[model samples]
Target chain A: MPEKSKSSPQAIGYLYGRRTRIFSLLGLGIILILIIGIATSIGSVPIPLGTTAGILVDKLPFVEITPTWQDATATIVLDIRLPRIILAGLVGAALAVAGATYQGLFRNPLADPYLIGVAQGASLGAVIGFLLPAAWNLSGMGVIPVFAFIGAIAATVVVYFLSRVGKTLPVTTLILAGVALSALLGSIVSYLVISSGSKLHSIVFWMMGSFSGSAWSEVFLVLPYIAVGIAVIVIFARLLNVMQLDEEQAQQLGVNVEKFKIILLAAATLITAASVAFVGTIGFVGIIIPHAVRLIWGADHRFLLPLSILTGAIFMILTDLVSRTVLAPTEIPIGVITAICGAPFFLYLLRRRKRAIF
Target chain B: MIELEMRNVTLGYDHHPVMEDVTFKASPGEVVGLIGPNGSGKSTIIRALSHLIRRKSGVITVGGRDIEKIKRQELACLLGVVPQLPLLPSTFTAFEIVLMGRNPHLGLFEAESRRDFEITRQAMARTGTGKLANRHVNELSGGEIQCLLIARVLVQETQAILLDEPTANLDIGRQEDILDLIKNLCRENNLTVLAAIHDLNLAAQYCDRLILINDKHIHAQGTPAEVITNANISRVYGAENCVFTHPVNGLPTVLLSALKKKEIGRNTISQR
Candidate 1:
């Protein structure tokens, strides 16, 4: 074929240019590090920035510095604050990426990590684990998360199969099925919570969501699941971009829509189930973080996923800090803080754009 | 030369068969138009050929290889489809949407290379969509989106192209421009083109062979002059005295008119 003569139309450049994207990524990275440092220093005890850095460095292998800070300060920073911060970051990043993936897969801006009954299912399982005799709890690797993961995958599978009409998976039907199943599972969880005689307070606390007792063990437990899930999602980021089009169009473009959907749903659900298993259901991070990223940067998943990870970590760290210090001796539930901070900002963004953010 | 052939193919959703025992062949360097009424399964045929929907029985082959046996990427490399109405993400730029056509050519982990960008850009230029590259798909007009879809198909660079109502939303000038582009591409690249067109005149003008479908089967298949006769149009389309040859090309065209009172009265009497 003969080449068509090109008449330039005064190039408008990319909507999100490469240079701007890279710079935003680097800037967010630096900001995240700074926020972590600042956040570690500002908790209830109010450790000095220098002392915090010294404690962190001292813990690093082969770089042992003399303990300049009090032993109590070291214990508080290393044993409590660090683990809580890291777990909060992991859970936030996991939820945000999972939310983004769900949004892209369903082609609905309203889609969140819990859209397909994962939360209710995990809650039901966790409640069951809580009610069980303390004998079932494995050493450090609690039985609740394992049951939650199983419950989450099973509920999603059920919803997926129920909503499928022949080979087509209609988004509306899927959402309806998820809602129905979620209500059913939620009732079961409530019933379980009511019947629990002595575990009521702890169960309710877990349900309300907290990182109060988060330990390095819980952090280590969630790290692999979130890391692996995020890696898989990032690998398929471009395909996820193509999937923003209707399923038939994606299929015509050589995407095995059904297979891709299954893989993505599994990965997103796994990370979400893992995150919620320990931290309870932290709301708003899944929905608000992705929307905020899309509002500032475009909806391209290549950028959306990584940007969500960074911003989600930062947002969670900041929110956790507020939850710790806002009421001082009485820390608020992190869920309450996220919703309080996230919902208003999200509404502001939606009103400002007044256009389709997806 | 690649040929798209569907032999004894039956397609439908669930248990209800829409088109049964359909057989046809679109050869290289030829344009075949599927002309039918609104519900005559024209789009179903296109979908089945693209493997967007499965055929119940028989086989669809591209370049003498069964489409079912071909992997999705390989099938996409062989055939490109422009859906009648495609839902695109509103936020995506035309450039990004067009660049996605290169997906079939790339490996699973491979991002678009410089060469792929060049090809996509060249396609946009050819289809006159370069000016719209930076614009969001949601902001584009219907004709602009149609042109972008065509540009995307061009970027695919397949051996066979399937289009469902390729010019459904275009004005007269753009309709001709798009058809002319497809024709030129067919001739130059030796690509087989199969398009489902509602406009009888346009089908007759552009298609080397026209397949008229009625009542879930192929009613007639031949050159425009042979297949689009007055008797065939009246019998299949239930329109009497509408067929006429185009003055410019001497190809068959249909002239439509409002239903007369006498015809309505006669039809009422017949019903009674």
Candidate 2:
């Protein structure tokens, strides 16, 4: 067959073309890799950028490089900084994708991973874990994340049941119920904090979120949840787009709205719980990164969801890097860094484009 | 080709019955217009037929199969709908909205392929909405949005179509154009169509048959001449004589007169 004419619309993949979408996914993947390598080298000792790349490439299969770096530098790159960098990226990707899922599922631009009380519940669980007697704290058990995970799931289930009117899971009711549960859980956490004696400072620091002493175990623990959650979320991307037309139209378009919503909610909540369980609640990423991706790459969730994964991972790593280095040993919270950097940058992007992002 | 039938269906919210034991059927290649007063279950019936809501007491079948037994995805391939007050995301482009009609055909892992794009573009062209493809949904006028909704439904390529007040926001010209397009498509494709139209005259002109709803029941069902008579209009709408034959086509037409003091019957006047 003859090549299609370029003047007509069919010559490309409708709007935004396949080129832009592919370029976005691939380009951001490369940037994320670069950011990870650079971030691993930037902390405390400040290793050289080339040495960081060499160290990273050396770890790949069958690649052997002559050791030019000191033993301490390798320890910093391989053992300490690499794990933290990987953890930050995984958490970031999880939170961002989860946020995008909530926004699409609720059809509200302001929605985030924490919108459904996942943060409050996780915090409560972490606080309880923090206050528990030392006898219960076993080595390598990682009690806090487990407690946080259970708390998050429990809170979501309560909210889901509360929001149902007959058989339908109304979005408005879901949001309202989430808000109500969040307030209740937040108050309980605060009470637990006040009643506790020596654990208060550690509790507050953990709640603020950080990758200060992240371990490879933490990364491994979080990988399965985030990976599965994101895979499920991407599969529902097209359905999420149709849902923007409201549930009534979605049903008419052939979606089982009730079943679909539950699946999405479960996936979003899972990744969010995984992310919050380890690093605390990183606020700005889930809410803003998706919007940023949408403003530049249209609102098709197929591209929007995947692009957010890359954008979010890079953003989280960079924010974690700044949090540790900008304060230099004092260690500003990662949550603080994310809000400070994300809001202004998102606003700048919004101002540059006159079109509506949501 | 499909035949849509609602057999003794009761539709409404919980503990409420908007319409009771309603029975109707539209055959293949038929345009069935549902005319009703406000709150008389037009939209409710449309929802029931499309499987958006379950019928309380009866069966709704499409193409001789129970709709309740059909999977939602398969039902979508068989039926398309143009909602009255559709909520289109403002950030989405018209082309993207239209392309969503192909959702039923796409698999979980699949993206929009070349053929889906071609069909969507053709649907937009057919509905005269090709010019608005790149424009955001919020930027378009209501009539334009309605036409885009039509284009979206057209992309479904279903064997049956449902429309709830499909021309409510449109001007007279666009109203006639959309109805004519719907009628032509119904006949040409041998597809079953059911539309809830508020305009009695427009419904008469375009619909192959009419089902007039009054007081939560299908009060009249027949051809335009049989159902659109002066007596039927006065009894169902509780209005004075307003039905007349169209000069051009001799189909039924309605021209309303302002309520005048003399037009009120002496009994209602005395009671007032």
Candidate 3:
């Protein structure tokens, strides 16, 4: 039997205390709003912080603030900066939550949204769409994201089936299968990218990832997919918690393991595909944001999902701001910024913690 | 109260058959011990009963309803299972793991209520796991994890419980405490329990009936005194001289002795 620690029960009560969770969630909410406002104010044409708030309030339904800011400032805040920030936030939230879900599903802390080749598949699809005849272009920004979503889902389905031996999904086998497939698909994408003569610059830029050309149209296009996917995941958060146990134990506890796995995989993949399709592939946000949240709060998905959503959004908005302003006129790829900032912090977390969290 | 019955259940993995034409019945308020050699499909039988795996043929029913026909949530309410080696997430606290037993009773969007917390706390208290509620499952010892699993099943509040070698990692005193607690719950709540146990003495002491499996079939089954005999033990387990009746209860008991050189050599040759 385990040795009884007199302090453990009290420690547990504190760790899972309801009030602490509520307060932390509330704090994150405030931080997200602050980051959005601050990020909106930091672009090339620096809009005053108060004017950024005023412009946002003016757009609200009933509340109309007198236009104190110039039309150019308003355009910068509302049209260009606001859409980019919101898209970045949405994609970040989507990737982080998807990452958390994948980590839980695979029972591996290293599992990320891109672990199963979603990014590579989406990249291939987007490249194909770009290489298609110009006559097929229906809108200014068209076909790429739709095709990307399809390719991501198709790749995930293929990986899932290939990894299954009978009814069991061994984690090691799944990761290996995903890695192998990702390498294959990535080569195909590289081959396609090389053959595209004049479109090399655009395709490479897309692959490197950025929120540069983000528009309200792109946001509207991805909204429904991300919204529905997140809603489904949030609804099944507790089931995800139960799924932390082995498949057999979860099944015995009345979770329809196979069905639940399918539903969660689909939802997570949908959001991830949508997030990556427009912004290319932002790496690290999905993996790091969730881990950062787990470090602060506990691993309860009920809290983890929502907290990850907020933290990811905040992190992405700040990273995007850094990408744009750090080197003026020439913007660094958002992926590079995320990697540079995230990798060192992740290493620090690894060095600081002694026990395995997962 | 629920009565569990399996009729000619054939269980296996893939196409390879392990246990064939197995049949058993345990009425409400009875504890049935499934005792067998390792690899004899004791855990497979429990898995089949829990619907973790499908039986190749025949029907397994609880309270006269086919387990296959029942919905997952409904079946979970009817029977709770304690797997021999459960893989739990290292980060989850014992309280959170125990609280998951309320999953079947909850709807898709429902959160645990105060009553659910009360029941889970009561289960932890009953299993003497209240002190360890804050600890991570990965940090816990094997015996503590076993007790935590039992607490989880108790919170499940099923009419029947199935345990797969539930006391394998526990000390002698802890083993008795857990078995006695299960036995008391069986008698008081009219719960049917089917446990796969390796320890024959504990089986004879706690189980109302015992099923001895040998060579993929039920070799002998009855009250402990009837099923555990010198001839049966010698044939099924190859322990001829070790089988003896208990002094106080008159039930069969196994006493181990150092094997003679010839006997050890013969057993080693046969194993090879």
Candidate 4:
């Protein structure tokens, strides 16, 4: 009889644990749909929430749409809102996924997509593109993004090599080196901003981050990278968990640690480069979203990586909506909104999981 | 009967040799303890044998197959290890941590099978950690965490186990518990165990044979009673100690030789 009671508690505990995981995933899914719908409904001319869903349904294959092609509702949904919403979702997912990958690759919870100074480097390049006299003529020609992508790659490479003193790169020292590089690059970017006084506003806006400039072209450009990056991360997720043990253990477990590190870091860097090229330096999404997901879901990378992507997409769309509608005609930079939202959450996470901060 | 053999093995880092000409063998159902003074290359020997670090020149063979010829996973399947003060990833639950033992068995891109879970569960039960299955490993006490690590190795289901100071950091009770667990597991499973133990008495009590290392060389190798002697202890460890038998088990034990009574200081007398 006593044994039965003891086993009963064990069985009940197992069931409860499984139930919570399911509930969390279901909750994230529901929030994602709601955020996408609400974000699509927001803008200068607010569309009804129902119309947003109807528009999405109309675009789906098997749904019969009797609405005329020339209808104002159809045009607003298909041409404008659809692309913007899709862009927001993709960028958010990309940033979040990139953040998760970097965190795992570094094996540091505090690490994010911005850890290797990629975002700062990309921001510097964007500033250079904006401040240059030729930028006025080169605007909308994809020059800014090209420069930004190059800057990100260069900065990450520098961080990578500088951190490798010999055969072994201690994680703490690597982080410190990355922080130093970020500061140096940041100062150089600030100098560029000050030197080009007339173009300072444009440069600052780009640095602050924004999705206001997102168009179908930028979205399409980033989509391939995001898809590829996510696929690479998903494929390597279990291998990353293996690496959480010492390198020797990971090797014994059939992971090529050096090869995996190179591939994972490259994929993460590619995602960040593609993302910042289009949306500027949107802070907090990449860093905070993955950690938040981890806090709730635990560290099964199989679940954490995909969940982070979904949550990140939803988070960005919601933040972008707030950025656009907060001040009717003039939009606040999406970076500002994300920072203002993310800093508090970061502090809360740090406070709640003080031991995990390190 | 020799399952694993290391012959004239040399190991070091970056062309600098730490230990050389180290040779040993552990046959099936035998417990061999490697005992040495600090820096005598006990860990270096284990690392070389496990292929965690490369050996400069030696022939290491498992089941008549050369160690170098075996793939990493295949080797892992042949031997499981319990490292000294293993640093574990904190985020995983006890079950998840144990389930990783199946990595050698898992196909790339394939999930763990139900059989894997059953094995993990049985390991946890054997280690008396089934109650903590759902708990995060980071939250466990040192003793509990050590058991979970042992459980992980058990789930690996290797024919041999290599333990490096597995109980070095535990309290006396926990150390005894872990040692007993390892001894029983090896006995029941007929496992070949090569353990690096610092406590000479514990090694004397449990090991079927002892290999004493001093200055990167084997000082003595035989039964505990044969290898652990006043002459060998004073020579190898540079310590003056007396040998005695355990009261219950009648195993050889050591006591440090005391100085003459006249040499005792007046301050020591006053303190006593």
Candidate 5:
């Protein structure tokens, strides 16, 4: 490479751009809280802010709200809002962390959980459940998540081994392998759906992503996977940062790059699989939320991973609210709302990053 | 004390050996230059020493401990390497890039301490890159990024530093600056430096000992004056060059013999 002229503009002073990022994150957090409070309050039956607060306060272990307000808000808040908010938060965080880790692990900003075949596999599993008469009997409506989780894990393993041709797992080859595998899994899912003529509607609706079936029991089921995944990623943040360098350099620097890669892959697969199991396949949340956080917080996985978790939670809660209200009584799929919101933002980023390689 | 020693070492890709029975020692407070033509196994020597690639046979010792017996983190604490081309993504700052040197000292969930920050700062200061500390590493000029990579090794604070063609892509001024910086670091800190240098003149200028490699063997090994003679240059590199003392530094240097293209072309044409 020839030396550039000294008179050219230098890429310094980029650190000062943090102020806007800090303010934006704060603003986003506030908006998240407002959306959760307001959206949850305006459901099939409207609950006033006063009543919502009363129900919320009463649920706290130590809080004692006034009798009248608690009675008015109890069923709406406890039976509906609490589960929905918790589910939204968990799903959002799960998707976001998965996105950030994938981006860092692959050393490509555009990589997401869905890009590596997790979503496709989960969708396939959901379709499989839809086809089986046993699964449809509602005797095993509860088993959908289990099937989806297993499918996701299987997809991740296939992609990983397909990319591992002997000692080196070149980034380009891995990404190409992922795309191919995703297409294969996607076709299988479509075939299953098409074959189940009567059950096609259920499969299609689930693929679109929804929170309509979320309940307190489902929330508990998904919580442990998301929590464990988040903990594992946070603990391994520093190791993930080291992995951005070439594998030889990273190994020489004392990182067990192969082991770390496996750990990250397993954690990311667990979270995405679990989140998609019950919530259906939510598009854009995994790809969009992490990118928004990274653009705000820089790419040190230590901070980026945690911040993405929070930002993801916020983004999902708000998007779910929009899905619920956009078509009153109709309850639009959350996936539809996220795609409509995320696609334009993604395009804007793509345009800005025309020359910027991550 | 011997900081690094390779004895009867053999290296290869998988099962086939590329180089055999190589022996060398880098004692504390000396800089050893590994010089050779392209594909002469210079980079392989660095890789084998750093444990980036497995050795086919023989023993490597660091600080009197067998390299194979040392754990990865333990080996890292004693040695560090600066690759020919350091990779940096657009998102990493110079400070963060240097901080990665602390990996050997950190636990799985550890955060950077004040001591770690101080060491990173000192490294930046030593490499004359403190002003660029917060700047994105990938956006910097090649020379600037090379300096930052050296700074990262400095932060590692290892007793031995291995460099593979560190100045290969640098301009003349930057090359001189980097070589001088490396010499100063070795002298001041008692660092055992083994650098694979492409420029023979630069190696002759800074290295206390030169090991000439060709055709997967040590062609010659001696002081610069003994190893950099015209006979050696012609035999090893197939270049018709005159050996002379550098006018200012009084060091052995090579001056290529003149050969007009028409004269060489006509000779080859006649022979054919």
Candidate 6:
């Protein structure tokens, strides 16, 4: 008897050009836009959706819309809310993509962006920057973000060196080294926090992660690094999929296992460090957003990477919106909002699926 | 088709040699089965052969060129492997997993083309896994995943194939089906094939030749009749196993001897 693929047309859809996958991505793109609009419209002054659309449309080069809104509202929308939202989206995207990358690289579903001590190192760097002389601020760039980036890179380098036995960097060794370093750096950060006299409040707030004073300059600063990192990762998406298998299998299929792991680990860490530099140490987004995206779309990293970006952005924007509005003039740390909101929703997804998210 | 040759190869982990000076060759259009005991380095041999492990003391070559001199991408195009019990991401559909076989053929920046998809579809169909295309890998049984792995290697289009415990997780009937598929493909395509199979009988039946590994080396190598003798089986496996002639094919078949079945009276041993 001849063996033929007589599976239904839907099965062919899975094997071939993924039409539905593309359409769904386009749909998510629209959802991202709507979320951006909503995030911008519903601030303290409460700009209407129509006015928000008009103000946004006027900014487009080819198209001009009459600015019926007041200059105050325009300033509030573009300068304040827009940049803040954009920064949140960027941080969210960076963490989510990095988280997904780490999860794939480690071949463990529990792996998160912060698994390798990026958050602890960045936080320690920020605290040291705070404790140092104010003259360390360079070129109007805040000392904390720069120091945080350096700290993150330094911490990862140490971990990498510590874990490497030879040419190969085993994933388990890297993870163990990271956990050990995180504990050390975390203690130093806490000790510094207790000793700091006046800057205690600011340091604690930064540790909790906030988008309170985001500016267009900060958004533009991190955007290039985050974009480049995510692009490099997406380019390796196919190889990353192969890496879901064990190292031996991956190498048998022609991937240079050690080199590929290093490249991805570097890319993920770079984005993660950049995100943490400006955003303090936001947690949960790195772990939860990937799960959320995997819950809806399958775990193909090609889609998973890009969709995680969009889903992460929308989720953070919404979470930040709640962080500001729920307290009504009193600001809460974005990290707190994420934990409160993300945990239950993540639990809901886990319970509903009742199986592996990876 | 490519020739896979291992000359005095010694493989190990962390400077500890697991297998020493192992030499074997699998020619095109031939299936060579590696038979050994539980810890006799069967998997280690496959790993070294595929260049997945560094050989401490000797050379392994593909098509007359040293594998160490070959670039990873080129090597991948020449050899494909089906490893034992590889973990697949739970959410990846079977088609997507099979589609990954095209990675070596694709450029770094290139996405999977339509032709790649067609090849994957055909491979899955041939492996009798077409219905599994839309199903997630997590939902599949171990046997089904093993079959899917075979399909992946088929789409890989390598001149040489290495299989590590290919039938370890399969049922009885599927075992024959997989071996038959491998044998037919090897002959049809004139591909060099090497499989590490635990079942001495199946290995003896399907393989053109058998290499018995013991004490971290090739203990015996020849035609199945020569390699699967009762003396060799007992020596390598440390068991008084019997090798019977297959009535239909006139090949050697191994049957493990029972450990002298004695009727156990419930109270026979020192009952008060």
Residue A138: error of model 5 in Å? Answer: 8.0
How many clashes show up per model? 0, 0, 0, 0, 0, 0
Q: What CA root-mean-square deviation does each model show from the true structure?
A: 3.1, 3.3, 3.1, 3.5, 4.4, 3.1
Q: List the candidates ranked by TM-score, beginning with the highest.
A: 2, 3, 1, 6, 5, 4
CA lDDT, every model vs. true structure: 0.88, 0.89, 0.88, 0.79, 0.80, 0.88
Highest DockQ among the candidates is held by which one? 6
Q: Write the per-residue lDDT of candidate 3 for residues B111-205, one digit (tens) a residue.
A: 88878877777788888898877788898999999999999999999999999999999999999999999999999999999999999999998
* Candidate 1 accuracy as lDDT: 0.88
- DockQ of every model listed? 0.52, 0.47, 0.49, 0.42, 0.38, 0.58
DockQ score for candidate 1: 0.52
Q: Can you write out model 5's per-residue Cα lDDT over B186-231, one digit (the tens) per residue?
A: 9988999999998889999999999998887888888899889888
Tens-place lDDT per residue, model 2, B1-272, is 98999888888888899998899999989899999899999999999988888888888898899998999999999999999967689987888889889999888888878889888877787787877888889999999999999999999999899999999999998898888889889989998999999999899999989999988899999998889998898888877678888999999999876543245566665776
Q: Supply candidate 2's per-residue lDDT for A43.
A: 76
Model 6's chain B yields a TM-score of: 0.94
Poorest lDDT segment (10 consecutive residues) of candidate 5 chain B: B257-266
Question: Model 2, A181-215: lDDT tens per residue?
Answer: 99999999999999888899988888889987888
- Candidate 1, residues A178-240, lDDT tens digits: the string is 999999999989988999989998788777688887899899988999999999999899999
- Between candidates 5 and 6, the TM-score winner: 6
Off by over 4 Å in 4: A1-19, A68-70, A131-141, A165-170, A246-254, A345-358, B64-69, B171-177, B247-250, B257-272
lDDT of 5 by residue, A265-308 (tens): 88988999999999888988887877766665677677678778
Clashing pairs in 1: none
Provide the TM-score of chain A alone for each candidate, in the order shown: 0.91, 0.95, 0.92, 0.87, 0.86, 0.96
Candidate ordering by DockQ (highest first): 6, 1, 3, 2, 4, 5
Looking at candidate 1 chain A, the ten consecutive residues that score lowest on lDDT are A1-10
For candidate 6, lDDT tens digit of each residue in A1-358?
A: 1275565532466745456667778998899998888899997899999888888878979997877889989899899999999999999999999999999999888889888888888988899999999877788778999999999988998999999987989999999999999999999888999999899999999988999889999999999989999999999998998888778778888899999999999999999999999989998999889988888777888889999999899889989999999998999999999999999998888788866776
The most accurate candidate by TM-score is 2
